[model samples]
Structures are given as C-alpha cells and as structure tokens.
Target chain A: MSESQQHHQSPGSPPASGLGLALFWVYVLLYIGFMGLVLVRPDLLSLRPFFGVNLAIVYGMGLIAAAFVLAVAYMVLRSGR
Target chain B: MLHETSIAAVTIFATFVLGVIGLSFFLGRKGQSASGYYAAHGQIHWFVNGIAFAGDYLSAASFLGICGMIAFSGYDGFLYSIGFLAGWVVALFVIAEPIKALGKFTFADALDSRFNSRGIKLSVAISTLVVSVFYLIPQMVGAGSLIKPLLGLPHEAGVILVGVTVTLIVVTAGMVSTTWVQFIKGSLLVFFCGVLTVLILGRGLAVNAGREGSENLTPQIRTVRPDGTVLVDGQPQSRDHDLRPVGTIIRLPERFAGQESTGPLGPLAYLATLEDSTIVTWATKKHADSEGVHTTYTPVERPGTELLKPGGFFKGLASGNLPDRLDFVSLMLALFCGTASLPHILIRYYTVKDAAAARKSTVVGIAVIGVFYVLTLYLGLGAMTSGALDPTDTNMAAPLLAKTFNETLFAIISAIAFTTVLGTVSGLIMAGSGAVAHDLVENVCGVRMTDHEKIRCGKLAAVGLGMVAMVLGILFRNFNVSFLVGWAFNIAASANLPALVMLLFWPRTTRQGIVAAVTVGMLASLTWILLSADTFEKVYGLSRDLALTPFSQPALITIPLGFLTLVVVSLLTPAPASLRR
Candidate 1:
C-alpha cells in the first residue's frame, strides 16, 4: 500500500490540541453546574426565571444547546488550522 | 390494557421489516471482504454516517423508553434526555478524532493500537461484549413492547422477531447494510417525531381531552391468575375487557379556569400552561390474593409545577434522603460518561474515512439528536395529557398517544418504532460480533484466518448474540426499558471510559494499566449492580431492604475507582519506552 493510503487506514493520533480540550472543559463545567443545582438547591431550579418555564427546563435545554454550539466552534476553529 | 390486532399496523410493520431485510440483501454483496463487513470499508459519506450515528445511538431506549418515562413521571424523564445528549459532547470533543485515527474495526483496536498487547485486547474485548449485551436487553424489551400494541402479539414473539431480523441484517451485510438501515431509520424517526411534535403544539392543551363521557374515574384492578388466565375489574380479560385509558388534565390554569381548552399554544406557552394545570397521573400497587396477583392503578392529581420539576419518577429528589439522592447523581454521571464508552458508538468512528470525518459526523449526530431530545419534552407532555396512557405499560405511551390522534399516525409511528429497534439491534450485534471474531478469536486467541473465514466467523458470532439478546429481553420484560438502559450506561461508563480517557491524555498509562482498569471497572460495576436494591427487588424478586448495596446506580463510585486503578497500576508498572518523554 502507498504510504498516504496506509496512513489513512492506520493513522496515529496527533498531539492533543488546546482548543478541543478547552471546549470540553467548558461543557464539563456546564454539565456539572446543572447536576450540582439539582442536588444542592433544586428549589432554585423550580423558580421560573423567564418564559414562564422553570430554571430546570431552561438550564437543561441550555446544556443541549451549548453542546451543539461548542461542537460547531471546535469544528470551525480546528478547520481554520 | 388490551390491544386488538390492526390490519393497517400489521401491514405497515411488515413492509418496514421486509424493506430493511431486502436492503440488507442488496448490500450483502459488497460486504464480502472483512474490511467492508466490519467498517463499510471506511468510505461512507460524512453526512450519511452522521445520520447513521443517530440511527445507531437512538435505540428503543431513547425513543420509547425516554418518551414513556417523561409521559409517566414528568421532568425526571427529560433528565435522561439531557444526560444522553451531553455524552455526545465528550464523543465529539475528546474521543471522536482519536478513536477514528487509531481503530480499524472494534473499540479494542483503538485501545490496543499503542500497546499491541494480548492482555489489552482480551480485556477490552470482554468489556465490549458485556456492555453490548447489557445494552441489547432494553432494545429487545422495547421491541416486545411495540409488537404487543402494533401487532397484538405476545412480548416474547416480538423479542424473537427482532432478534431473528437483526441477526439476519448483521449476518447478511454487516456494517454496510447496518449503516444504510440506520440512516433510513434515523431520518424517519426524527422526521415523524417532528411531525408528531407539531401536531401536539397545534392541538394544544385540553381539559380532560379524550375523557368525554368517562365520568367514572375510579382506579382499575387487573389480576393475573396462577393458571395463566387474566382478569380486569373481576371480569375475564379480552379484547372488550381491560383497564380504562388514563392521563389527562383535571383542571387548567387559574387564568384559563372553566375553559375547556387553551387553543393552540406555542412551545413556551405549552410549558407555561402545563405548569399551572392540575394533571392526573397514575400510581400502581400490587398484592397477592386468593384469586391471583392483583394490581391496582390509582389516579393521583399532581400540580404541573411539581411534575415539571426533578422528582416524580426519581423519588430521590422528592424524598431528599442521602442514599436516594446519591443514586440519582450516580445515574446522571453514568449517562454523561457512557456515550463515548459504548462499543457500538466507538466502532462507528472506524466507518468514516478519517479523523476529520469522524469529528464532523459527531457534530452532525449531536444536531440531530439534540433536536429529537428537545421534541421529546413536548411529545411526552402531550401524551401525559392526551388521556390515552395504558396503566399497565408505560413503554407504550408514545405509540398510544399517536393512536389518540389517528389510527394511521399510530400505524406509521409504531412501524417506525419497530424499525428503530431493527436499526439499533443490528448495530449492537455488529459490535458484539466484531468483539468475538476480530478481538477475541484473531487477536486474543491468536487464531489466523483468511478474509472469507473472518466474515464467516463474525456471522456466527452475530447469530449467537441474537439468541442471547432474545433470552434477556424475555427475562426482563416487566422493568421499564429506560430503567434497564441505565444499568447499561453504568457498566459501559465504569468499565470502558476510564481506560480510554487515560490512554489518550495521560502519558504514564501502561499496557498492564489498561487491562487492569477495564477488568476492575467491569467487575466492580457488575458486582455493585447485582447487589443493588433495584436488582434485589426487580431481578431476584426479593425485598429491597435485604439488598447489600446502599444505593442502586454505581457509576459515582465505580467510575472513579476505574481511574484510580489505572493511575495506581500505571505508576507501579514501567512505562513503555515509546511513551517516555
């Protein structure tokens, strides 16, 4: 097999990038914050901050939205390199 | 609840199943080579592979289980949706590119790439098999749940049908057919669910929506006799005799009081309206009697505000007890970490051409999955107030909710759901077969084989796994499908995640450490689950108080134990020369 084709088939891992790791920890903190609120102060989640929906719903939906946004960010930032 | 066999449902379901199998046969010719059979020759387009990821990941658990959970319990079910989607972030940001770059076919290929150790191959392969089988249980149970309502067949028949069909799909074309099947299933599921959600928003909220003449809102009683005969409300159960359909709004918001309906609310308005309504949810109690085992479904009126919070089904959030609270945290932790650790999910990275495709596909998967999960909140709440829930089977909430709208929608949704089972079960069987054929036989046992021989071995493995899945599906029929899936996430997260993450980020990871982590993680979580209170009450049919473990979900404890084992073992052992800086 040609070297390029072989590399495609069995490519080695490149060094870990800073941007991806940073994006990952950013999500980790968001997820942990949601879990922490649910455990410690669930009453706060019950409060309807906006849209007449509870903070729990808002935060949960936000986590899903944040994941997609951060993922797109990583894809765009990494492709630039 | 009783279901009459519907000709339209049966026909749509048969067409779906046959169409999937025919597609497999058409794709079978291309999967003759081992590489093609295992990874679709790594040539699938990024967009197609992305949708295919949704097909593979959104199992019966995500569709039927999560929807039913939300319908029956309220906000606690959506908690699963958030946790499940969050795991994809880990997949995309951390595991996606690296896994694609390192592995050719199985997750073991990625783990063993740097070490090339038989120990790593053997342990990781075993972990893959355990996780796959655990995950397969819920899909098969979901199949049984769908078939009972759609075709009016028994649960075991549904399990067998799915097992046989999924085995055929895997043995016929392997990943090539599996990918296409998933693409079709994923696209149909998201599109139809989108349609269903719009219908829900358009219909809006109603006071006692389908309970027009049902003034007798009494709790219904069902009994199963030792002689295998069944009775509902002291009458023999039949097509004409069954528990009354339940779940509806008892009262609307104070602003809309005395109003029959709040016409066509928007998404936010729907939640805001439901938050103020008084919803009637069911609670069940069982007791053994001289006649048989009688179960009663009693109606409980809960405020929309309470149901919209975190405690309805979890009970821990409501009780605020330490053990219960810890169990909830542990389950959420497992759901967060488990996505990247699943064997079927990991192997999908190998089906793409390169690391970049893997990364792109994961992003695509998140978008599709995220949209579906958002819709789940609506679909579930819609069902909760649709006045069409079967008290005996929460898993049938979504399909039955479709029935409340129209029989044709019910037929189409149930058919798509059956295909949902087919798509996910095939992917799981593919992962299991790869573990058995490539990882265990070829690498661990050192059995050399030609390409044709390898393909044959994988087909055999697929058949074996299908049979195992069928048996487990039958044995665990009574448990909620989503609850069973939680056990799978716990095992996969505890057993696979620690080793995988450390191997990529930590330089001191040794070959021995990988083996130790996988083995210890797998065993610890499995042992914890077997001793848990949920298992005691559900599996062994014993009292929960007699259980050995303090809490049910084990990921909170076992996941950290996995990382600790890896770190401690790697420090004790010498690092490979290449890993040294």
Candidate 2:
C-alpha cells in the first residue's frame, strides 16, 4: 500500500479483513437458511422444538441471540489479535 | 377513534421537546467549526455513541409500529423486530471499521475517498438524500400520530411540530446535540420499555381482562366521510362517542380451563401459555360508499398456534404461491442488507474517533438493540391481551397498552416516543444536510466554501429537508409506520449497499462503476416501488391488479442488479490511474 493509503489504515490491531469477511458470511448463511425455511418448509417453524414454544419463536429469538454472540466473538477475536 | 387530549400527556410531551431543544442550545457553542457541526469533531465516546445508535435506530417504527403490529397481527410484527436487528450484523462485521477509516462527513465522502469523481459524489449524495427522505416519512408520520392523543392537534400539526423542532436541533448544534439527544432518548426508551414489560408480566394474562360488557363482542365500524367527518357505528365520533378499544383473551389452555386469569407468569411460561390460548383478534374489511370510506373491524377468535406463525401479515408465507413467497424473502433480504447502507446510520461512524471505537460502539448497539427487540414480543403479546387496542390505528397499540395500566405511565411512554421521533429526524436531517452542503455543493458543484459558509449551507439544507419531510409525512399519513420503513430499507439496500460493499471489497471497482451502481440501483428500486401493487392500491388509489411489478420489494432483484452493473461497467472501462498499480 502507498504511504497515504497506509495512513488511513485503522489503528489498534492489524486489519481483520479476513476475519470480518468470514464472520459476515457465517451470518449470511444463517440468515439465508432462515429465509429458506420460511419459504420451503415453513411448517417446520411451527413445531414445538423446545420449551413448549414453537420453532418459529425459538429460531427467531435465536437469530437475535446469535447476532449478539457473533458480535461479541468478533470483538474478542479482534482484540486478541 | 376520537382521542381526548390529556393535560398530563401535553405537559410531559412539551417538557420532553423543550428539554431536547434546551440541550441543543447548550451544546450549540461547540459546533462552530464545520467538523464539529458535521461530525461532532469525531469526539463522541464509544459508549455514548453506542447508546445513541440505539436511540437513532429505535424510532417510532421499532417502538410504536412493531408493538402495534405484534398486537394486531401476532408474530408477524416480531418478524420486523428480528429483521431490523439482524441488519446490524452486517453493519458490525462488514461496514463498521472501513466506514470509520474512509468517510469524513457523509456517506458520499466514503464513496468518493478513492476517486475524486464528481459523478460518484453527486450520485451517492443524491442517493443519501433520497434514502434520508424515505426514512424521514415514517418518523414524521409517527410524530403526527402521537400529537392527536398527546396534544389534541391534527396530524399535519404534529408533522409540522416535529419538523420545526428537529430543524432547530440540527441547525443549532448538528451532530453534537443530535448524538446526546439520541443517547438520552435511547436510554429512556429501553429503561421505560423494560418497566412496561415488568408491569405486563406482573399483570399476567386474563380472559376478558378489561371488557365490561357486550360492546367489544361484536364488529365495530369506523367511517370517514369525503368532507373528513368521522363516524363510529353510524354515530359521529366525539370524545364521548368513540370506537370501543378491542383485543382480548377469549379462552385459556386446557390445563387452565375455566380459570379467570393466570397470575404473573415467567417470560418463557408467558409465551408457552399464550401458545395454547384462544385470543380475539380483529380482521378489517373496507368499502367506499357515497357517505365515504367505511372500515369494519370484526372480531375473529384465533387459536394461539395460528397467531404465533409467520402467515398473519406476510400472507404469502401461508398461500404457498411462488410470487408471494418470493416477495416475503425479498423483504427480509432488504431489511438485512439495508441497515449498514442507511445514510443516517453510516454518518454515525464519523461521530466516534477510530475504527476500534466504531467496532466497540456497534457491539454496544447490538446488545442494546437486541434486548429491546426481544422485549417487543412480550410487549406486543401483552398489548394483544390488554384489551385496550385502538382497532383503527395499530400504531397506537403500545401507548394504549400502557394506558390500560395507568395514565401516568401512558403519558411518560408517549413523551419518550415523541423524543424518539425527534432523535431519529435530527439524525436524518443531519445526514441529508451533510450530503447537500459537504458533498453536492462543495465537491460536486465545485463551490468554494469556508468552514463558516459550509455550516451555514448545511443549516439551510436542514431547514429545507425538514419542510419536505413534513409535507411527505402529511401526504402519507395513513401508512403503517413499519410498512413504510420497509420501503426505505428496500431503497437503502438496493441503491447504496452494493456500491459500498463492492467499493470496499473489490479492487477493480472504478469510479464509473460506483456512479452507475448507485444511480441504477436507486432509480430501479424507486421505479419498482412506484409501480408495485401496494403503491397502486394504497398510494395511487387504484386496483392492485393494475400494478406493473410482480412484487412490492425490489431489493432481491435490484441489489444484484447494482452489483452486476458495477462489475460489467468496471471491466468494460480502462482502470483508473490509482487502480493501475
């Protein structure tokens, strides 16, 4: 990279471009899977998977939880780098 | 439904508005510099910025709209909460650090950072303005909705009130005041919502909880005449004569059969219990007569299992048709991709100091936003059983739910909701004004400007955009706030996300590519929305059969179209000198 380009390099740890991309794709797959289920096999979402609540509520809430988990994991992984 | 103005609500609402304006004036001294006015001099703390992200994001759509949707339509409303929060994943993992490293003021600055192309600057700036205005419509409409019950003002008055107040806030201190307002609003919203959730849990669920007589057992009719006179059940609607509030639990689970109420259930238990119950939900049918438009809301008893499924609002999920299913998938994709691309959200990256702060703030934002979205389910369900729903306006679900508990709580929640509009509107106006002054005027138009001149130009743009927001808000008053926000998301995802993603990740992305992607993406999505069935039926007042587009949301098609346009154009043209390395 040129000196000017390097100047704009984000401070702190080295750029986690690969890690970010990997984490992002992981989320993309999960989100797309969600859409896939809703499209192809929506009946699966209504099954009582656990806790007496249906898969629809469980999976929906799980997506939100997964986002937070992945976000914290990214922060931790990047800081350790 | 007629809403009697409450003095307490008016007082609390005024205090909140005046407090926001007061904070703007107090912080006005710090925004003398262009950097300060536009980006808060990049001095905002990560923690404060994080909460402010919540404040800016959890607009009337998230609070009032989602809760109302859930109250009226069951789990479908929670789908919006999920889709909205999911978009932040893209923001945190993909856009956060790079956006911080590249952009100085507006989203255009980031796009034009590599190539000083006026084409890129102009296209991206205009895209930013379009998305901001689209986003502004919901907030302004939400403001109008709140004004009726809180101040007894007309919808237009509420829109004007919010427009004028937000313009003053943006003109006074720009991002500095905007950030603090968001932080305060965000904190209060989450805290009070938490309180309300606890109250709901404590009250628990009851069969016919607040019903007094046979009044709510039958269908209710609300009619609006051509001259704008409203009638309820063939009687003119006044404060004393209004449509009865609806929403009730009709039956309990077999385990709790013959029980009057289930007291103070746990969160998981609450959902599980509601899963087996029978609830009375309203289904509406509308017809136009010489008298005017008459909407009849009929009570329908639905099993809890059906209400907890995906097909209530997105009927395509249940219809099993190819086109309808594609439409549902397309809307979800748009919501997921749109958050990271929003101009108002993107500009916030510049408010903090570094890429690290940006990342940290995003993490903070995700945690706060995630918790609130989870709480939305409980709030919506509680409102569903609260038996205080305004069947005519689903947007009033949450506030009216609070009213069932006590008037004081209702007043406070409504005030918080009003500030929620102010915070979001100010952020949007700031983004719009920055695009106008910093990007279009200075960069694209080649207008030379001093720091003072730039700030002056930005303030003028804020006033202009605020007025536009009010006008559009008034025009689109009947739309569900969350549904309207879906249009904004689709446009943001289609127009901005492809260009931003390709520019950052792909090396061969030329200036011409960015310009082409933005313009094509924007125009395609806007044109598609204008011709879609929903717009034909809702906005144009024509039969949906006359619509051109097969689906309402265009992101699934247009987002890919944007990326393809950029790649093809980039390959066709010779590389820029900078990329020739």
**lDDT score of residue B148 within candidate 1:** 92
Candidate 1 CAPRI-style tier: medium
Report lDDT (Cα) of residue B388, candidate 2.
88
Per-residue lDDT of B1-581 in model 1, one digit per residue for the tens? 77877888888889999999999999999998999999999999989999999999988889999899999999999999999999998888888877777788999998988888999999999999999999999999999999998888899999999999999999999999999999999999999999999999998888888356642568889999999898999999887887888899988999987778898899999999999999999889999978899999889888999999999888988889999999999999999999999999999988888777888899999999999999889989999999988988878989998998888899999999999999999999999999999999999999999999999999999999999999999999988888999999999999999999998888788989999999999999999999999999999999999999999999999999999999999999998667664
- TM-scores of all models? 0.98, 0.97
lDDT measured at residue B134 in model 2 versus the true structure, 0 to 100: 95
lDDT of 1 by residue, A1-81 (tens): 432254445423443467888899999999999988998899999999878999999999999999999989998987787
lDDT for model 1: 0.91
List residue ranges in candidate 2 displaced over 4 A: A1-16, B213-215
Q: Give the per-residue lDDT digits (tens) of candidate 2, residues B394-500.
A: 78888888888988899999999999999999999999999999999999899999999999999999999999999999999998899999999999999999988
- Real contacts recovered, all predictions: 0.58, 0.57
Q: Using DockQ as the measure, which candidate wins? A: 1
